[model samples]
Target: MKTILFLLRKEFLQIFRNRVIVAMIFVMPIIQLLILANAANYEVRNLKLQVIDQDHSSWSRQLVGHFTASPYFNLTGMVASAKKGITAIEADEADLVLHIPSGFERALRREGTASVHLNINAINGVKAGLASSYAQTIILDLHQEIMPVVELPAGLSSTFRYWYNPDMDYYTFMVPGILVLLVTLVGMFLSGLNIVKEKEIGTIEQINVSPIRKHQFIIGKLLPFWIIAQVELALGLTVGWLVFDIPIVGSLGVVFAFSSIYLLVVLGIGLLVSTFTDTQQQAMFISWFFLVIFILMSGLFTPIESMPGWAQQITRLNPVTYFVDVVRLVLLKGSSWWDIRSQWIALSIFAVVINGAAVLNYRKTD
Candidate 1:
């Protein structure tokens, strides 16, 4: 009991003594939260549009007006010919080109249907897809407005309501996931480097020759990081709320409770890495390799359901995936403990298995 406390004290002292680490512990979360929450957005905006308007009619000009009025598009200029519009796209000056033929207004008035050619640069697939979708929607809206109203018998109509994120603000969706990432990074990188650093500096030799038992030494090494990670999580959540206006719809206690177990899983991974590696650099490289795999497969930036079947199955093994789901569910959807019970159990099992492996692998003497 007293021995573990003494070891914890020693670890905390060592952590605070390093100026760079202290700054990272306090500063990194705020900077990352502020920047990434704003920068890592999926919403496509400010697409450059060049229009080739051969139709010098009201409907043609009205269609051009629609593109100019939209926030999603910036109409660079009106070209006299389709050739010029194509040249703009080739020169990387425009993302999309709208070509309105000379008979466009006549076709709309006579046949009630007009075709507008859209030439979109497909260099960035996602941007192209979104820009195409947005332009199509705008054109469809104008078509509906200008066409004569037809009375039809009412059958069924569907209305969409976005539940958690009503405004569809990307920041709301990203902040919680980014918070989980920050906590995971601090726990894994710092704890993984701790023991290996001691080994490098000839301090592990002294600890191995001491009276400390294996589990006690592991606990001593793990607890400081565990506590620091929780503090980091709390700080991150606060920043998310204060800076980004992210709401915590669920119980804060539930958040902390789940975080306690999740931190153990992350810290256990670090300790396991430390047990196998002799130097901090080796531990860092190994930790980063696993971290990248875990984060990418975790559904932080992309939907796991959209992944291939084998890739989705792989995500089931990633601990970050579960935490990301749990945090978003709790903070965004106001999910209760029962809602996250399955994730909680999975993380608990991971905590036991990983920490057990780390302890078994650690030799009392070298």
Candidate 2:
């Protein structure tokens, strides 16, 4: 126990002694958080649309006017025909192309039947889906207003807003998740490469000959990085609150608990990677690759629902998923511990299992 404490103190001093690394550890993430928080919004807007109106009647003009007036739609093209509109959409010039059937006004007024073709690019499935739904709703609302004398079913209403985020501040939703990811990258990358660096420098042999046990030495090495990571997290949260005005409406204890558990998993991953690689470059590359894959799959930049079934299933095993969820829940949704009990359990279990494997794989003797 004494050895462990001594090692922890030693590691802490070694990390803090490097002023440049400490500055980067805090500043880089805040910079990224500030820049990306604005750009990573899920709110759909200015959706480019092409109108292929075959019926050049007053009613068709009115429909086109609906598109022009809508905040959701940006009328980018008024093409001669549906074929041209579809061509524009296929060429990626437009996100949505609406082809009103021939004699649309005649059919609606005289025959009470008309179909509007809607072409939406599903490449970005989530935004495309939302845009398509919004377009459809606007058209329906137009029809309802036009036919006001017609009676409607009793249990139907369109009185709710989606509120992708009610506050509409992108940073509120983004900072928590992205900050967690940024810490994951730092923790995993630095710690994973530390042992490999010592080995490369031939300093590991000296540690091996010392009276310190493997566990003590290992714990000591991690102690400094762990505390630094926590300080970085605190700085990130401070930035989130001070700059973006993002609310942290949940318990700080829960946030700390989950963060500590999540760090264990990240550090375990780093240690495990160190065991396999002999060089710092190899460790760095391996760590970055894993971090990229985990972040992409962890539903940080986009919704997991937007991904395919197999891809979504793959994220279930990623440790970053739980961390992102925990932070987002505590920060944005004000989720209580009970609300995140299952996530806590899962992260804790993964931390234990992964750290155990790392310790097992890590070399003790030089």
Candidate 3:
């Protein structure tokens, strides 16, 4: 116990001595959160719309007006010819082109039907799909307003109620996930770098020659980082609540409880990576490789359901995926411990296995 406490004190002293690393541990994540929370948005907005209205009728004008009024679209160019609208799309100035055919209102009133040509830039498939969906919704709303009797079928109506995120704000969805990322970045990178920094400064050999046990050294290394990561997470969540208006629907105690175990997984992986590498560069590259894969597969930006079956199966092995899932489930959905029992259990098993491997791989004499 005395030996381990000595190692812990030494590790903390060394950490506090490095001003640049100390700043990185505390400052970088907050800056990343401020920038990334606004940037990592999935919601499609400001779609550049080009319109060619041949009919020039009041009804056609009203439809065009809807597109301009909608927050989803910006009418950047209006041309008399379809050729010009197509030019705007080809030139990359517009994302969508709308063509209202001649006699659009006349055909709608007389024949109860009209055709509108929609040309979309399909370069970015996701953005194109969202733009199409937004346009369709506006068109449907316009149809119900103009020809209420024809659009409705004997009192059949549909109502949408959004749960959790009522306004469908992207920040609400991204902030919690980003907080997970911030904690993860610190846990994996800082812990991995801590041991490697010792190797670089020649203190690793000095410690290995002393009568210090391996487990004591490893525990000393992990404890400081675990505490630091939790502090960063608390600060980040406070910032999220104050700046982004994110709500903590579940118990903060539950969040910290889950996070404590989850940090074991992240710190264990970091220790494992450090054991295999001699230099900070090697540790950083290895950690970055896995962290990138974990973040991408974690469904932070995209939906896991949209992934192929085999890819989704691979995500089950990723601890980041479980943490991201449980964090959002707890914070946004107010999910109880019972609701996330399977995930918490999986993470516990993962922590035990990973740390066990790290302990075995760490050699005192090497």
Candidate 3 vs. truth: CA RMSD? 1.6
Task: Please identify model 3 stretches exceeding 4 Å from their true place.
Answer: 149-157
lDDT of 3 by residue, 1-366 (tens): 998888889878988898887888789989999999999987888999999999989989999989999999999988878888888999998999999999998888777878788899999999999999999988977788876745533246588999998898888899999999999999999999889888899988998898888888999999999999999999999999999999899878888899999999999999999999999999999999999999999999888999999999989999999988988899889998889999999999999999999999988864
Q: List, residue by residue over 1-366, the lDDT tens digit for candidate 2.
A: 998887777666766787866666877788888888877877788999898888888777888898889888899978888778878988988999988877887767665556788989889988898988888887886677656433333245566654435856778778888888888988998788778988899888888788877678778777777877887888888988899888888887789878888888898899889988999999998888988899998988868888999998888888898888888888776788899989888888888888888888876663
Q: Could you tell me how far off, in angstroms, the CA of residue 46 lies in candidate 1 after the best superposition?
A: 1.3
Instruction: Report the candidate with higher lDDT, 1 versus 2.
Output: 1
- Give the clashing residue pairs of candidate 1, or none: none
The local lDDT score (0 to 100) that residue 35 gets in candidate 1 is 91
- The TM-scores of all predictions, comma-separated, are 0.95, 0.85, 0.96
Which residue segments of model 1 deviate by more than 4 Å?
148-158
Residue pairs clashing, model 3: none
Clashes of each: 0, 0, 0
Q: For model 2, what is the alpha-carbon lDDT of residue 234?
A: 88
Q: What's the residue-level lDDT of 144 in candidate 1?
A: 63
Question: Candidate 2 at 316: error in angstroms?
Answer: 3.6
